[model samples]
Target: MKPHKLPFENRWSNGEHGWQWHCELERLGLMNVRAMFADHETRHPGKRAVIFDIPGGFVRDWLAFHDRRTARQQFLWRAIVIGLTLVTAVGTVLNLLRL
Candidate 1:
């Protein structure tokens, strides 16, 4: 593996309480970004930031499912913003031409 030459501590071994959980997920090619921000203790004592145990067989599917939702949300938001910007630009141009 290539060494990360960054001038700071390794992220995978940071002091964060849930660092181990995210490290395991990265090894399995899955991620729960939300957990990296804030995590709370659960009623099920053993469970940490991951909340659910993702079996090896479902890791790929879980990644796909999670990433797809993120993509769809970002696409919708960007499309709306771009469409609104275009409409405003065209309206301004037309108004200027009328003057």
Candidate 2:
């Protein structure tokens, strides 16, 4: 299978179509994989094509980084929510005691 080509110039140009172009490229790669698998099946019986060869630590590291970032954001939001709730509860208690 030929390597997929990327539109580097357009991607780096800060254009809105960068994501659209990426999706198109992904679709094209999938189509190519289907075609390659079909050809492989005809030529070799009972064998599967290895379409992707990812490094061992890549996915794990990516997930760990994503989890850390997500946790940080969640902590920030939770702190803000808790602070607001505490303030509201305190205000209610003070108003009731004064009445």
Estimate the TM-score of every prediction. Answer: 0.46, 0.46
Per-model C-alpha lDDT, please? 0.49, 0.50
RMSD of 1: 9.6
- The weakest ten consecutive residues by lDDT in model 2 span 53-62
Count residue pairs with overlapping backbones in model 1: 0
lDDT of 2 by residue, 1-99 (tens): 444443332213234433343444355554564465455556753443222432213222333444576799999999999999999999999999999
lDDT of 1 by residue, 16-64 (tens): 4234434455564433433422232233334432435433223333445
